[model samples]
Target: MAHIGPAYGSLAANQAKISAKRDPALDQEVQTWIETIIGEKFPNGSYEDALKDGVILCKLMNKLQPNSIPKYATSGGSFKLRENIALFQTAARAYGLEDAELFQSVDLFEKRNIPQVTQCLFALGRHAQRHHFNGPILGPKMSEANMREFTEEQLNAAKNALPLLNEGMNKGANQSGQNFGLTRHI
Candidate 1:
């Protein structure tokens, strides 16, 4: 059962689902992080409203990496505000944050997906440690590579018999003895 609506309807539904799953605690953490980094308080009560214009984001990026955003329009139209977000995203990517950790400008400017905005902020906070910036950390610390070296004998032994993984499943079960529905007639 479905409606013959336009293709964009599904996108709206997805946005609604994401918007519904927003966690207030995460939002508050993101807000605190941005404000602490930028040294400016959020103008609005909620994090989304405070960052919709993208100004604080630019400030955050700059604080993380000085002059990352050379120019972020503080007073302008929608296009200029959107540009600020784009600049922040580019700078964030350059700072080692993956594309998946960044959010689209439309997500914040148009308010289409607030959860993504928060997620992006959290990722930024988590990724900030990479720059060695002397600031408060957010979320779990990004783990470092723990390389392990093995001897040739150990490698050969592992190839010969993977004792740990070779342990086959001994827990057995069969439904042949039990009848779920009506019995078959011969």
Candidate 2:
């Protein structure tokens, strides 16, 4: 056998083998970590559902990494990548993960800027979405009407109260006065 240097053709073969073994292990770790986060976030949630959320969380996190959070219009309107985190966290907590590890990882004081927390949450949410863990969490939709007129404190209160109120939408919730698009009425 000939000695293959770094530039040699063997490098591709070696790299492939390494990646093959590493990918699965990395995915397992991600799965476990997501499970832990989801478990803490949604203590009453079923194991199966939590597992699904975990996978989606991983996908969302990946999107957040390297600066790629989706810009699709959300309940909060046209928010940037960072603000998307806050929106996601607000929704996540509403879905029953108030003490989610994703929030715990952020340090309010250390991070300083509000964007930091938002970005972190966005990243985490992105990761969650990537693995097909995310789905429609049953809860009252935060309409743009309220989001625009409400103060930050008021919005926070609503986000906080969402988990307590109910899971999923309220069939009778009115949307005539909704400030954003019809879809954003949620």
Candidate 3:
């Protein structure tokens, strides 16, 4: 249902916020990441223009996870192009990107919110690194899980030590009713 109470007043402000987030350096970095992952350079266009048709992105998904997008349009009508974008989006979701991390298809297809498009790419790159995509690293390496198993005796000893720790912590320190630092004066 179309909402009559949509926040129209803040639309421009939100647009400005998104626009401010655009960084040419990040665009270049993301472009490099995509090109490296897909192992192909754009024919002749800006990063946004190169990815607008979604062919590159679909290829990227397939490269990361074989057959992610079984078939994508190399060139065709608008509907075909949009389908390519949609397939990429679906593959991204299936590949483990949170909804917030994925950009809307229209963002790239219509060239709106190119910053978000770049943001989505960076997120994907980071996630791919986390998932160990077996390609050149994209973003920072993901930290590995460190799990420590404690014996029952160790757990019991730690539990019994808590009271001793709390006693020392509560010996004489407190801020229950004390004001810290100078209060601001009007």
Tens-digit lDDT string for candidate 1 (1-186): 124354367787886688688898988888888778778789856678789888888888899899988988998887888888888889998988899888887777766678888888778877887667799898888788999999999999888985643465433544375656768899
**On TM-score, who's better, 1 or 2?**
1
lDDT score at residue 43, model 1, on the 0-100 scale:
88
| Candidate 2: regions farther than 4 A off | 1-28, 31-79, 100-186
The lDDT of model 1 is 0.81
Predictions: Cα RMSD each: 6.0, 24.8, 5.4
Candidate 3 C-alpha lDDT tens digits along 22-50: 89999988888788888899878787889
Worst 10 residues of 1 by lDDT: 165-174
Give the candidate order by descending lDDT.
Answer: 3, 1, 2
Candidate 3: the clashing residue pairs are: none
- Considering every candidate listed, which one attains the maximal TM-score? 1
Candidates 2 and 3 compared: the better one by TM-score is 3
Clashes (N, CA, C under 3 Å) per candidate: 0, 26, 0
Residue 16 deviation, candidate 1, in Å? 3.0
| Model 2 alpha-carbon miss at residue 166, Å | 48
Off by over 4 Å in 3: 1-9, 163-186
